[model samples]
Target: MLTTNDLMTIDPETVTADVPLREVVAVMNRANIRQVLVVDGKKLVGIVTDRDVRLAVNSPLTTEEPLQRLELLNGFKAKDCMTSNPRCVTPETPIHKVAELLSMYKFGALPVVKDDALVGIITVTDLLNQMALIPEPKS
Candidate 1:
């Protein structure tokens, strides 16, 4: 069975809490990734995704409010938009388990950790790729 280490993307792009929302978007665009890990020193604190950005910008409360309101009210930093205490998996975790977690939680990705250190990330795309390599069982 494949493990997370076999399919995870190591040293994935990360953003600090203080990084501006605009810059986080830029990094996501440049990296061609939907999510980014938010870190403080070596600790994995949170995760920011494109969906989070969209939700923050298009939230009903902000509909009539000026864009500047985000800066004042939301702090305009990765920490503000990021989801803290994100669900994580370890490198030794089975790929099928990761798939089950993602499916059950509707998550696009999960951070892979070992010894409480961020090591890599596994995404739906990775699972799909792995699935493609597996032969179907006889009915």
Candidate 2:
């Protein structure tokens, strides 16, 4: 049975609450990742994703603004757009269980915690990778 720790991306890319959204996008682009954990000190506080940025950019309030203006304003800070109180999993959680939770809740990723400390993250991509590694069942 695979555990979350076995498939999770350890020391995953993270951003500080005060980091500008532009910087976050740059980091995500550089890392080729779609999601980033928002941290304060050493504690995981929230999560930010490309979807969040898209929502902010496409919001009615910002729709009429010029691209540059929108980017400048929307790119304020991670805390301004991050999803707080994000659902999390533990290192000991079974991979299948995490998959179930993610599917049931429509979550793309889940932070892994131990003693309330951030350890890693498991994303849908990670789960897909794990599934790919599994052998096919006999017919």
lDDT (C-alpha, whole model) for all candidates:
0.88, 0.88
Query: lDDT by residue for model 2 over 40-67, one digit each (tens)?
Result: 8668999998899777666776556578
| Stretches of model 2 off by over 4 angstroms after superposition | 64-66, 73-75
Residues 12-123, candidate 1: write the lDDT tens digits: 9998999888888889999999999998876799999989998777766665656664553345788988999799999999988999999999999999888888898999
Which prediction has the highest TM-score against the true structure? 2
Question: How many clashes would you count in candidate 2?
Answer: 0
What lDDT is reached at residue 120 by model 2? 95
Clashes of 1: 0
- Model 1 clash pairs? none
* Clashes per candidate, residues 3 or more apart or on different chains: 0, 0
